[model samples]
Target: MEAATKPKLRVATTSLAGCFGCHMSFLDIDERLFDLVKLVEFDRSPLTDIKHCGPCDIGIIEGGLCNAENVHVLREFRANCKTLIAIGACAVNGGLPAQRNHLSLASILEEVYHAQHGLVDGFIPNDPELPLPLDKVHPIHEVVKVDYFIPGCPPSGDAIWKVLTDLLAGREPELGHGLIHYD
Candidate 1:
């Protein structure tokens, strides 16, 4: 008898306003990444440098939405991915960037461009190529329907691996104790 060949899961990933730490944690899987490839394959990700996402079984998002481009990319992922997972504090709750949400956009811009205490670039940057920042950063769920969340400053590599394996196995992911935290 011959063993059946299981369909490989297609995955896509991206970072928005985040520090890309979640992706780093995913990479922390290190040698386990080889085992992962046996069960899945990347579609659009930093690993592949594929500019656009195609149809994928899972989409892992690693940051908060902070600009027009982020919103656009997130929507594109939602359209192309069957399941979307928000990873890290940034993707779940805007993370470090959300600290600026209390201040108005103008004030933040003024601090960056006109503050006497900082680098004295006298004018606010108005580059046509840059995407405009939103008034506030937002969690992935605010922008799209997130199928799952891996919460942490950056969820540990082991935690991420467990989730991925469980999802691939068609089981609801069981987050063990100490796997999730606010800080």
Candidate 2:
């Protein structure tokens, strides 16, 4: 009798404070994404158009937490995914967004809005539709336990592929010196 084939792993992904560059890098895998699709199914990712994540085997977070919504999504992913990987410098250490951490939120807001010379009814936005900004941006690990980290301003596609394939094979991922970097 032939051995039964294993089911594809369900994966979820999200971006927080940083740019969606990490997702772009994932897409940089080019034609190899077809191979990834064969190994895993996406849930609650921009690629899948899923509104919310259901039970998932892996979660890939690509940015840092900068607001209440990011916290909510990160917590939700933690609850749903058995293994979570922080991908890119943002998710691993707050990246560029965390640069504002040295300043008070009010000062940062003022610098962006009040300090601007544009003439208008300048006022801090308080729309309910917008997620409330946190006092400071934080890495994903500060909010939830991350099983793995892929370092880089945006990790290269090859680095991401290695991590994914290693996880699928149930082995501890070993990133080479070339792959371990923060830009």
Candidate 3:
């Protein structure tokens, strides 16, 4: 009965190959946040990460796919998250950093270390846990099918809140277009 007593919205948010600005923006909901705590439980995210994605009513994913780990996480998110939402430009079109796709890996490294920073060390440690940078960054949809998308480099806090609340009520979030388009 307690299970039914609690609001039945379970939500999880994860950050992939992008900065955590999107997640931080979601946190900026401030006073409105406790409302979600009563209605929805966060299953995985930097905020309340229990490691695994777990099963949830909705999944909010920020960032793009850049390497093997990203592919694995994105797929897992797709499997566990019932209503998956791709949050931010990184999830939509790989974002600005993805522009590196236009250049070679060696060029990128050389520029970052040898040319720009003028560092002698460009060697990578061969730790098993460390991820090797991929040839390019990729949008989440490129790797998995997404149920919805919230566009913006880092979507406004109001945007994230509206989506979550609407989804919780089993209503289709009214997506405003022009400057903003919910996918």
Give the best candidate by lDDT: 1
Compute each candidate's TM-score over C-alphas: 0.95, 0.95, 0.88
lDDT of 1 by residue, 21-135 (tens): 8999999999999888888899888889799999999999999999999999999999999999999999999999999998999998987888858676588888999999999
Order of models, best lDDT first: 1, 2, 3
lDDT values, one for every candidate: 0.91, 0.90, 0.82
User: Where is the poorest 10-residue window by lDDT in model 3?
Assistant: 174-183
Q: Please count the clashing residue pairs in each candidate, in the order shown.
A: 0, 0, 1
lDDT tens digits by residue: candidate 2, 1-183? 111266878999988776999999999889998888887889999877798889999999999999999999999999999999999999999998898898999987886777778836677878999999999999999989999999998899889989998888888998898887798
RMSD of each: 1.8, 1.8, 2.8
| Segments of candidate 3 deviating more than 4 angstroms | 1-7, 177-183
User: Of the candidates numbered 1 and 3, which has the greater TM-score value?
Assistant: 1
List ranges where model 2 is wrong by over 4 Å. Answer: 1-4
- Best-matching candidate per TM-score: 2
Candidate 3, 1-183: lDDT as tens digits: 353596667788888897998988898898899877777777888877489888888888899987788888888889998888999999988987789998998787767756765467765345789777779999988878898888987888888888877777779976586437532
Candidate 3, residue 59: the lDDT equals 87
